[model samples]
Target: MSRHSEIKKTVLRGVYEDNAGIPRSTHGKRQSKFAADSQEPVHSSRYPGKAVLVAVLGLVALLGFNLRLVTVDVAGPAAMQVVEEQPLPSYRVQLPVPVSPVGALIPGNDQLVSPEPIQSLDDATITSGRYDTMLTRLGMPMADLFNLQVQTIVIDPGHGGIDPGATGHLGLKEKDVVLDIAKRLRDKLAVTGKYRVLLTREGDRKVFLKERVAFAKENRADLFISTHVNSLPPGAGSLNYVETYYFGPHTDQRSLELAEKENRDSDYAMGDFREVIARIGDTLKTEESKQLANSIHKHLYNNMKRRNRGLIDAGAKTGPFMVLLGVEVPSVLIEVSCISNKAEEARLSTPEYRDRIADYLKTGIVDYLEERAHRRTIEGGIIQNVAKQER
Candidate 1:
């Protein structure tokens, strides 16, 4: 056979051997070198191993691609950021910082934001800037005016002119005694430069109850204090004491009779007093006047008792007097002493005693005003709290 025929026979022989599940080798073959080499047997096992290796590599590559897709940040690009963590929700409230009255609560963006946690309007705080007070936000001034201090005081010296009032046995006239006291008190208050003190009558002149009230009203007095001396009836025993009276219905028979004596003038009738009382609601005016009376009586009684033994504190009482009628401000009628008593009349006759009494009255008034200012501060705080809650 020719070499080409020999090569074809070698390939066909290998195919037939492989198909028949037989192993073929070139070891004993009698053929040319090319035919012998072509007759080498193919290993089916090796082919299957290479195929498996390729399939496994392809599967691994697919799995790796799927894992990359799952791990990618598709939502957004990575970026650097700084942020304040939001606080947990809370209903905690903190008291606002106490802002003094030295400066008005300026309604503007310039005011500082309260670092204190506050219950905000919409329950969430604005991260942009500070929070302003409700009043400031509304552009309303602080109600400091509502918390007023005692300024102008009207001192009415009772029983001037035709009315001599009660005269002591030593001829110590109630009008003269009280006028001196009022003048001394006015001077004392004026020297301090804290008050504007005015008298209804400067000298031993006549002044009607109506005129006195009108003077106080026209001047816009913050307080009205009428000074007087008390005397008992013929049968009543001489009593030495201090008494303070506020305008109201009589608290007792003695008060009623005293009111009658003080209300004798023709300026205001019983009907007029009735009208004034009817117009009053819930006795607020009466309560305020009573407070004034109590304050004065406390100081007057305490101070006088030091010098005058057995000096009684008859206590603050309510009595309707013409001088106090229709007077809007906190008013009181103080019976500084009893002219009916021999010792008290003797003391009233002296200038030193009168000066001392004036000093006591001044101190008492100062005490009342100080207490009132403190109370007003507390009330202002409450008003602020209410305003905060409302906001």
Candidate 2:
């Protein structure tokens, strides 16, 4: 054997001698060679773990800082927005200072005046008599604080010429009857000299609903009264009565039907008037119109009752009457009598009955005007007192 083989055998002999193994000669030589041929062992250093932990912490810190900046940037403008959306304050006026009392004696006068004639502040009197004269000139009620005095009245005779309203069994036309009544009313009111009465139509002629309302506005009327006659349909049982109406929502089905009937004319249908009526439906003089209707209705019912024993009082109703729209004044429609009924028709045909209606209607107008004047007197006094205090 060579020297190298001899060295290896020597190492094996030592290993076998120590362990007393039988195969140590070949196995020990192979094991020593395999161990010598292997690579060097690697060692883990503490710096690598520390470096990983530091890098993770740095990344976490950077993310946390960026999140804080995002939160502030998003929330800052929203916070400012709330502060910017506030309303401005309203304006206030400065009031005038009160004045002191004047000297008891007249200025530039040397003569000694009686102290008894000089009234103290506590003895100052507030007389309403002065306001009454001013209120009367304005055509306002003298006794009421807020009342309108009637100066100009417009009497509208419903349906004329081409439009012959409702017809009676006795050949009496509604247009003719109402026109005569209107003329009589105009004449009666003219005699008073207190009111400026004007008729919408002088003779039997076709007058549109719009024209009637326009006339009242053009004349600057304080009150508008439209006269008409009520009639029942052929199927409806005879309903003979006197009723008054003001422009408003219909009170009942009957009032609506009556409004529909009265609104119909040869020149225009219900459709045309509806749009016009709706346009001017919001009336500022609703309360005044109601008062006028009630006043006229009461007098009509009371006066007609004396003449006709079985006169039915239908009371005041509210209906959308085209003639009453856009009047710019207190307006009412008076259904004098039921021309469809034989007995009522006979009465309406007579001159005496028409004259009676005209008289009662005039009385109602005068009463309303006087009451309004009385109300104005009270209002004027209050306003005068306020003016004096302000001064």
Highest TM-score: give the candidate number. Answer: 1
Candidate 1 per-residue C-alpha lDDT over 1-391 given as tens digits, one digit per residue, 9 for 90 to 100 = 9999997996785454223321112123234445546656634331224344346435644654221111111111111111124332221212122233211111111112322122333432221121122222321112222455678999999988889899988888999999999999999989989899999999887777788889999998888999998897656536687899988766788887777787777455666677655444223345456556766786788789888777877878767777776687778999999898888899888999999999989987876666556544543443343333333
- For model 2, give the 10-residue run with minimal summed lDDT: 67-76
TM-score of 2: 0.59
List model 2 lDDT by residue over 1-391, tens digit each: 9999997996775454323311111111123333564554433231223344346435644654221110001112233344346522211111111122222111111111111122332122112322332222222222122334567899999999988999999989999998999999999999888888899998889988778877898998888999999998866426678899988777788887888877764356556656755444322255457656766886788778777767788877678776776576778999988888888888888999888888888877766565545434533433343333333
lDDT of each: 0.64, 0.62
lDDT of 1 at 246: 82
Q: Kindly give the number of clashing pairs for every candidate.
A: 0, 13
Compute the lDDT of residue 11 as modeled in candidate 2: 70
Alpha carbon lDDT at 26, candidate 2:
10
- Native-vs-model 1 lDDT? 0.64
The true-versus-predicted C-alpha distance at residue 67 of model 2, in Å, is 62
